[model samples]
Target: MEQSGNQNITDYDLIKGSIAGDPRIQEILYQRFAPKMYAICLRYAGNNDDAQDLLQEGFIKVFRNLEKFRNEGSFEGWLRRVFVNTSIEHYRRKVHLNSISEKEEVGIEDVSVSVLDQLAERDIVQLVQELSPGYRAVFNLYVIEGYSHKEIGEILGISEGTSKSQLARAKSILQKKVAEHLGVTRK
Candidate 1:
């Protein structure tokens, strides 16, 4: 079949085709959203491998619940939410977020603007990757994913305080990593 070069395919059309069980349309939808959604998953996942897993899992949820979308907003927004939730679900399944301690949970406020300016996007992503899974999850969820501590805790099956602690630890670790990269020592 001839593929259109990123033509403006309406969500209505895509949804119709998907509901009709047209495999080609489904593939097209996947191709369209996968790259952007994969990046979202990557931010939440601790490593590239886990990111890929979350990407697949997220896509699965997207396809499975495609019909439920109410067309009240941008399809991309709806899809993005699915991918985010999928990433959170993946973490919840793999980690006991509830087990975090107050010392382990880090608040996000400690992450400084100066530090962020010192690093590029890729550098920040790498710093996040270096964090332990629990710290990384809370950091990504709160900082990157814009989830509240309460939401992060609920998603991870941990208390809000644990999420706060994890985020703080994540910030401290990231600051150290960034400082090391910049040849600076903390006072």
Candidate 2:
């Protein structure tokens, strides 16, 4: 291992050193990715305390499973998948997703792209944070993480229809919240 500082070390070297049980390398890897991972954790967790916990848990998973990475894709991408899965696992443990009835699923309005574009990213994240756990998981998985409904269903142990309904409900709620935040009526 290079005794040089983190600045000069490549990700490859960091991975190798971490796999070899080098505490310094593991810390460096955590420092490099924690901010972005924390953002993801916050998005799924919907609060700082849970986000912090998720971040720590995600890193533990990453370090424990570091040897499984085959280098076929970007390490950052792999790290993101791990954190997202960790967050989803946390959500599953805390919430039992109930499918919305057809009667309740009716009248879900889509938010305009223009309205969403008007808000800052932080504002958007805050709005998303207000979503219920099931809605939030479906929203993040389908919209942010780019998973298909079937994929989300499998990940969250729900039906594809349930995932679709959850996402629709999440969008509807967000639209209403955004409208209220901007002092605009949806009618």
Candidate 3:
């Protein structure tokens, strides 16, 4: 137990302490990852209140499942997976994807895409937040999390085509919103 200080305590040590049910180490771990994880929660949530709820719920799951961690890959990655899954599951309980549009319009594939270079990260995230829940989920899963359409289909219980269609619609919707923000018409 190299408890020199919070900074000196490795993630392995923190996980072990959390597994042993030490409140102090759990607190340390929470303090360490909460900000980043909260950002993720916020992206999936409709607003800050839900983001806070997701954050608290995510930390609870992390501590409860601390013993199951195999220490295989980055612990942060594992923790992120847990948080993403938590958000997905929480969202699943709250909404259905039936309303996600099935229309896949042409021309988006050839779009230059450089318009985003002019925008800040906060601006883009705000645009993503403006999407419907299904569109938002597909966008985050495909773009931010780097999940393949097939994997998204499996996770979200939609068909692969549905996942792809939802992502396309989300992108189309975002493009329109961004164009509106910039006061330019889509080409």
Clashing pairs in 2: none
Candidate 1 pairs with clashing backbones: 105-165, 105-166, 106-164, 106-165, 106-166, 106-167, 106-168, 106-169, 107-168
lDDT of 2 by residue, 71-145 (tens): 989999999999998999999889888767766656554444358889999999899999999999999998899
Between the candidate structures 2 and 3, which one is better when assessed by TM-score?
2
Better of 1 and 3 by TM-score: 3
Go through the candidates in order and give each one's C-alpha lDDT: 0.79, 0.88, 0.85
Candidate 3's C-alpha runs over 4 A off are 1-4, 99-113
At residue 135, what lDDT does model 2 achieve?
A: 90
> Candidate 2: misplaced stretches above 4 Å?
1-5, 102-113
Looking at model 2, residue 44 earns an lDDT score of 94
Tell me the tens digit of each residue's lDDT in model 3 across 30-104.
988888898999889988899999999999899889888998999999999999999999889998985533454
Decide which is better by lDDT, 1 or 2: 2
Candidate 1's TM-score reads 0.86
Compare the candidates by lDDT and give the number of the best one.
2
